[model samples]
Target: MTDQHAPVVVAARRTWIGTVGRGHHERTETDLAAAVLAATACDLRGLGNDTPTDDVVLGSCTGPGGNVARAAALAAGLGVGVPGLTVDRQCGSGLAAVIAAAQQVRAGDARLVLAGGTESASRAPQRAHRAPHGLTPYARAAFTPAPWADPDMGAAADALARRRGITRERQDAYAVRSHTLARAAHAAGRFGPESVPVGDRLDRDERARRLDPDVVGRLRAAFTPDGTVTAATASPVSDGAAVVAVVPESVRRDLRVPGLRVVATASVGCDPALPGWGPVPATRAVLDRAGWSVADLRAVEIVEAFAAQVLAMTDALGLDPLGGDERVCADGGALALGHPWGATGAVSVVRLFSRLVRAGAPAGARGLATAAVGGGTGVAALVEVVR
Candidate 1:
């Protein structure tokens, strides 16, 4: 194993079981955090380790009191002595936590770490929308607002599609494929292992359910009064959590854990006014850092925050249109499966894990994951399936 500090390599390396909150449980942020921690503890038990974690890193976009990580660690049965920190990077929080944790291990500051994210969009904080008063006339007119753009994400998606020549019909078609693949994967139990059952009432409530095309077609657009982007094509507000175990390569060898390796990871910022295009630069950065071409990737998982966003990146990356069977998010994406902000990153990582195991893909088989965030920030990670 490389030295903990001054290591030349850093990777996500290992993942534990991923847990989702009860779909119908109506859980609070605290409840969801506790549930995720419990699930992580159970996973650690499966790995046959009783040692206290060196550190805990939790991510939540709308965490209450901004202390979800510490609260979760304490609730999960970890000793009070264990340290924890919380992170919020909007939709990319989970991935950001993973990245930060891996860096710590690589930097030698930590050896054993628990990294994951949780969010209860159902319990999202309510705040009065306020406009900045200090901005100059030029800035006020030209600048986008916080929490969301002035016109909002849906509106931005609509404008982008129009500018990029993407049609409403094409976006709808992508949504249909998302539902179909999601339904098939659920039926076949592709997500059975990765998903943890939540709530005492509902034994299992996977968010990726089948959608009615007729009902989808009847829905009105959200952003544009007469635009094409509808709730059907956009990700739903949901509650969920996912956790990963990060350990040094040497420690992984000692544990004898299978399937451990890192490929590439990158983050980038773009024009906040045109936030929908954030993933394009982020994807390019990851590929450039890893010295791999798009064609070299076996599968891609671009967070479907919006249909047009995914469509825009597909074109930018020169990927096949969503209709093709070869494209990623084969089991649907945020649109059909739901996006729990903080948990979405881990959700994507878990999906990639399932895909690799199912295909029995060889080592070096590349998978790319990317997400666009609120502040024109985007993150991308590349993983190679290890055998």
Candidate 2:
């Protein structure tokens, strides 16, 4: 492709995140993804036939082994002819899926694509191996090589917190801020625009209202007896889905879809031991590719798998973590909203979409959405308002 067309996100939407085994406990992963995909497609429908998309690309980590994307596409009534691709790349899967869709558009193989991620922690099947003897419950899947020292995500976060000198107090404070902002945003109806209600009610984020300062301060370490990481500071397991409509810039005018144009994308590998720091390199790489600086971005959304994870990235990137800076997750983050592993990264993109496109921010407003992966990888993308 000589003159590759740039990719742009025209529509974005997400399901109201619900606590695991609560609001969406009965919903399947395919159904959640289909719901969000249908909402996003409906958002595009206003553009008429110009909104036609070529495929559906989805991401998941704990979903059933088969091609969940195909199931979701069919369930969403996207037509049996539309091909679907499913990707699993740990925590970064969602953003990576969006990047993959954008690449297809850039390569001219697709004019429009539906890309995002979904997760149903409540409905995820418990793993167990059948054996001649009694079956043993599976604890977790390997995320890295045996030699790389694979630690459970919570333990890894605790290790990073200790290494970075991030105190338990700091993590708790950050968690409090997340809930405060998220609740305030919710009360102001800020989330209504991007979130779709589910199951006979306008579902709200269950974790956003669970803030208790004294309770958080007294919580014990979740992974280690003396570690800093705790349940209060970590993102809760939740069920939800989020997706975006990606179209080539060539069709933006014809479709009258005003949104963010993709500027650059990056996926970088890092040390598996310190997974929380992955976003630092990922964001830097994307900015370098676009020849832009941190100063160029008006907003940033680095998924908060844990409060310490976000703080570590802020420190590495020279951002003010406690200064009430509006550039970083102005509304809130996963700590308050809950993290549906596979969908968390795409939720960050939806945050950017709401801030840059729906909020009527100044023209050319730029934002970067980035995330750290479980297996020593970081993924990020830089985008700007097309107007």
Candidate 3:
């Protein structure tokens, strides 16, 4: 918990993100996670720190009930000595798992931990709720109680966009920017080094295409007739996994590699009606704890579940939403990359590691990763590049 024993991320890696029913339809969550875990472990060994992993913690949203973390750990060949834990906090699952691992390391209970998230939307099994009379089928479980408002994510995003006065033009512009940057990043080979190929495809994404702004303007609203949210503005049903190896600063120094030192973390609750607002309070909390403001951040990454949702968060945080804030999602976000639910939170961190550490940013340059959960929650972590 102190400065000496602070947790740091020594290595990060992720599987190739694919569309739900297209590229990753045959691969399950366990498969995707195992691939990334093995890749991260290889990274550790490459750094000459092959200490056995103390735990394997993963987050999942739609996985079948059994301990999928343990299954994934075994699938990754972590052996029986390591235990596993699975966390489900809606979309914030991956970040929550990472923070949990960090806390364990801070407490001196774990020397090394591998943590991240996975999602297999295509492989999500059908479910039937058992009622008194018979069985009732449902698409997805509710995020709020029956008495509270729990609209579908798209509908809620559309409603929030309308309520917050975020017009269609702004939303479409953001979406186009995301696609353009993501495509450019991939073309420049910025993503290849961080990717762990899982299937036939190697270091390629199926969703990152530049959307014509003219065409984006003509598309109809998907949630409401007058709403601004559209297919292009929302993240797709995706499948992928991402993990980071967490250790104390001492271990990182011995490995002779720079890392992102955990400065502070915050997880907070907000109104369920507009879940996009979750990140606002969470980000503020971390900034407050770290005694830094938005202007001090060198880079920032937020899970782009929806264009309108992320815009709302950025707008509230006093960051320019259009293009002035290059530090925020410079390479793009889930909009173009695909939102694999539980895996999205971890993906944000990996992107930060790329933007900061991999890019040779000076030591102490701070970066942040934050996410908005579906069930009225936000999770965020503040880290700085450590030499």
Candidate 4:
């Protein structure tokens, strides 16, 4: 009963994620995004379709001000006919872009699209407004207006951990598990198929193993005074890009390629003060729309913005396999892979593609990807394997 005209993600790829100021320091968002775009385009063609892409939809946060999607599209040699759009939903930006592209394909407005996200935190220093007296700098952008409180992600995570009763030891244990899984994946070459080398240099993550419990145990709180949340529990500010080719199901049929079929997507709003809870509602909505429950999902990916936040989500969602859930982040998550804010959501999708599609899961096998945004929003997509 699969819809042949529905949009399917046939190819997914990402550049090696790096710590903000170290590996990709000299590369802009455009440079990193363009590399993956080009690689993903090759994937599209290799699947036996050279039809020019209809559009480029990308998401970014704190990138070089202008329209980075358009710039990256041209830089990737997509030609002048293809237009581009950029979306920003804070940390949810990347998944939002993919959902936007799927909407276009569903409406028959476009046949094929490239969608994902990119971020260059190192290159994007704090921006300032042109004041009459001089320049006024702000630490971060405002997500809410008066009356409502919008604390930084670090502080919010600490508060959320305490409110949710997530112990610091549990968070530290999860952190170690993430690194352990990621290292196992890397040693087995699990990342090579989906990861592209950046700048012909080290194409690996820079900050994970430093989180030794003895070491992490001694580290002080990063945001709140006397808080349990520490550097070891939070994802680092990182830089990277990821892209996927979303094509009509007819294309997948024609190419004889197995891919993830876009089934349903949901976005929900929550209290700005507790943005991490956004995923709880968003995931529920998407699953309801798809007529599928957690028990039916073969794989799930949730951005690991913080160990406490991720644990809260898993607990709320009733997913019981907490210690080593192969169904959840079998390879790793942002904790070990590095969360390039805007790009991490798409990276989630890419990981699902690798886990389900590339691994040859049975037809109709389902997977999910979700992310919690800083602006009190959550986005989730339900996809199925079509063989």
Candidate 5:
């Protein structure tokens, strides 16, 4: 028999709602934060609710001093007393924030919360810092890897591609599919309602358009000397933000909003040397916790950190690389949408929500979302389509 007192709260309603960023160019960290907050506020208004949010969680991999979340909360018009937390788990930061928010809700810590992630790769470059001389000798020694090991994601991606037997042709094919799906979604106006357009100041949503065919050919190999991965095949360094509002099932029913539910979430760490494989263990952990199998999932959104990483994950999961059994990144992924580091994971969730709603899957149908991060850490979340 089921435990009647078990936490039965659902996700309520999660809307991609709004996104804002500069065109495919550099944007200020403050601007990105403000844009994200503004978009979130607009989305809240659309929900037609004035209830005070219990908490705010923001994800960001890079930003001005790593304070994007706090700044965003303030800019979004939340009260000064409203608690806010910023999370950074590399590429999975945003998704991690969402998972954390959901966990808090399930544990009865809060009845309602706002969760999302943002990134400004163009404005916030990868950072390297020196440890203070006050540290112990051993501490300093251990910190050596911090500076030297900060390799470009492209280089890491190239290495993984070659090691994992991913070929140039396969990468190109995936790129083509990503663009095709993104173009289709845009043309069909599927992403229109969710995308909050930036104003004349920004002129365009930096990552909201299709890739250029000519640019695809002109791209040079990235990372290794003869690496197959190119800028075209890899996700662009761009800026963007996404947010979701989570509430209790009772509140959902009262409000009459149909949404998704968080079933399980897991974060796992692996050897930093094999960063690309982090998702394998994370996936296993979530599935184990939920007692579900890959066969039970109707859709999956594995962050495309690189073509090779996606290829490796699919192979590890025993999924057909070319089959359509699971709608994997049915819309273009980071490769096409741009990887805003901390925002990518949350963005993946938004995509998952959009895809599930469109497919009209039955209640209890599962969706798996995963993202690989630096230092061999990955996060995965299992969500159910709530009836």
Candidate 6:
């Protein structure tokens, strides 16, 4: 019953994620994006000769502020004939780029497309706007007109934890588990196939993998006085890139490439004051559209913006947040691996591809990748392994 013309992911890859200003400091966002895009293109070609890519779409939050997608395509040697586009939907940018490409393929605009996201936090430009009459500069952008209501991420996380009865101890425990799982997955070489070396060094996510419960507990609150939310529970600023090749299912069959059918995508808006809750409704929307329930998913990846937020989401979905199910980010998540802003969502897709496609899961095994965006936006995508 699989639709041969459905959009499918045939290849997926990502640069080794790095902490902000450390691992990929020497490289530009374009450099990171080009590396992943080129690797994906080469992989697609290796699979077959007729897989012509029509466009490249990339999501970026704060780069050099130009059309980074175009720059990356040219840098990847994909030729000027391939058009490019860049999107900025905060944390959802990466997944949104993939969705946009998938829609184009579904509309029969193109047979193949490259889509994903990249972010070089270290190189992100320092932005400022001139005041009236060229007075003082504004250093930050406002997410809402009511400044008092728009809480910083940490404040929102702390509030969510308090309202949801998620204790500081529980958050710390979840962080520890994330690190533990990530280290174990890395030791098992789980990241080898999907990870690409970045810059002049071998690829590795050299973030906070080692965890000491006592140390994490002792860390002071990062955003609010007497708050439970700390740096340990929040996603770190990071740099990286990820890309997936989207082709029709028929093309996948012709090339003998394993297919991960993108069955449905959903995006929704929530209260800008509490952005973390965005994922709940978005995931619900997608599942409803696909006529599937959360329990039906074989694997799931939710951006780890904060442990408290993730805990809330798990409760909403009626799942155990720290149970360490193989279906939920088996290789760890943003808490341990670091969050590369725009690239995090696409990284989730790359993880799904690895879990269901590269690992040869049984046909029809379903997966989900969802994220809560900065401006109270949530995006989710559902995919199924196709034979």
Could you estimate the TM-score for every candidate? 0.85, 0.97, 0.98, 0.98, 0.84, 0.97
Q: What C-alpha lDDT, on a 0 to 100 scale, does residue 74 get in candidate 3?
A: 95
Tens-digit lDDT track of model 6 for 187-305:
98889899989766645787857888999999999888978889999999999999999988778888876778999999999877778888999999999999999889999999998
Compared with the true structure, model 2 gives a TM-score of: 0.97
- lDDT by residue (tens digit), candidate 5, 210-231: 5565666567797778888886
Q: In lDDT terms, how accurate is model 1?
A: 0.69
Question: In candidate 1, how many Å is residue 378 off?
Answer: 1.1
lDDT of 1 by residue, 221-246 (tens): 88888678887788777777777766
Ranking by lDDT: 3, 4, 6, 2, 1, 5
Q: TM-score of the candidate numbered 6?
A: 0.97
Task: Please identify model 3 stretches exceeding 4 Å from their true place.
Answer: 132-134
In model 1, what lDDT does residue 108 have?
76
- On the 0 to 100 scale, the lDDT of residue 38 in model 6 is 91
Estimate the overall C-alpha local distance difference test score of candidate 2.
0.87
What's the true lDDT of residue 52 in model 1?
58
Q: Which candidate ranks first by lDDT, i.e. highest?
A: 3
**Candidate 6 RMSD to the correct structure:** 1.5
RMSD of 3: 1.3
What's each prediction's clash count? 1, 0, 0, 0, 0, 0
lDDT of 2 at 375: 76
Candidates' RMSD to native: 5.0, 1.8, 1.3, 1.2, 4.8, 1.5
| Model with the higher TM-score, candidate 1 or 5 | 1
**lDDT of prediction 4:** 0.89
Taking the tens digit of each residue's C-alpha lDDT, what string does model 2 give over 148-195?
978788888998898888888889989988888899999999999999
* Overall lDDT per candidate, in order of appearance: 0.69, 0.87, 0.90, 0.89, 0.69, 0.88
